[model samples]
Target: MISKEIVVANKTGIHARPASMFVKTATQFKSNITVTKDGKTANGKSLITILSLQLVKGSNITISADGADAAEAVDTLIKMVESKFGEE
Candidate 1:
């Protein structure tokens, strides 16, 4: 498994739109993905699971992936978060 911690950068953090985008991105890879925050972990491919975390601006979370594309999946997710989900 591969993992990296990132801070939510978007103004609204991972709300509806962003959360949808994140879940979509996660499904693009074949790896098993999970996101954890403050001792809570959620399935990255599930909208309800992700939204339940209540990740907001400045919140810290660790994203991890396991599978053949683990590294790529983890890197892509980190980039997405660092890019503020392209919302600027």
Candidate 2:
């Protein structure tokens, strides 16, 4: 498994549209992905699971991937969050 903790950069954090985008992108990889916020964790490929977390700006979470392309998955996702989901 590969994991990295990063702050939610989007001003609105992960919600609705951004959450959908995240879930969609996560599914592009064959790796098993999980995102954890606080004490809660969700399936990174499920939009419902992600949106239910209601993550907010400044929140810290860990993104992890395990499988064939774990390293690339983690790195790409880190870059996505750092992009603020285009809210930048």
Candidate 3:
């Protein structure tokens, strides 16, 4: 398993569109992806699960992945978070 932490930089955090985008990205890999915040864990490939976390701006989240593409999954997720989910 591989894990990396990132801070939400988007103004709206991971709501609606961003959550959809995140879930889409996560589903691209074969690895099992999970995200955690404040002790709450959610499946990265599920919009409902991600949205349930209520990750607001400045919230710290850990992205973890386990499987053949674990490292790539975690790294890509970190990049997505760092990129503010492309919200600018």
- What do the candidate models score in CA lDDT, each in turn? 0.95, 0.89, 0.94
**What is the model-wide C-alpha lDDT for candidate 1?**
0.95
lDDT of 1 by residue, 28-56 (tens): 99999999999999999999999999999
* Number of clashing pairs per prediction, in order: 0, 0, 0
Give residue 6's lDDT in candidate 2 (0 to 100).
97
Give one digit per residue, the lDDT tens place, for model 3 in 22-88: 8999999999999999999999999999999999999999999999999999998899889887789
In model 2, the worst 10-residue window by lDDT is: 15-24
Q: Candidate 2, 69: how far from true, in Å? A: 0.6
Q: For model 3, give the 10-residue run with minimal summed lDDT.
A: 78-87
Candidate 3 regions exceeding 4 Å error are none
* Order by lDDT, highest first: 1, 3, 2
Model 2 steric clash total? 0
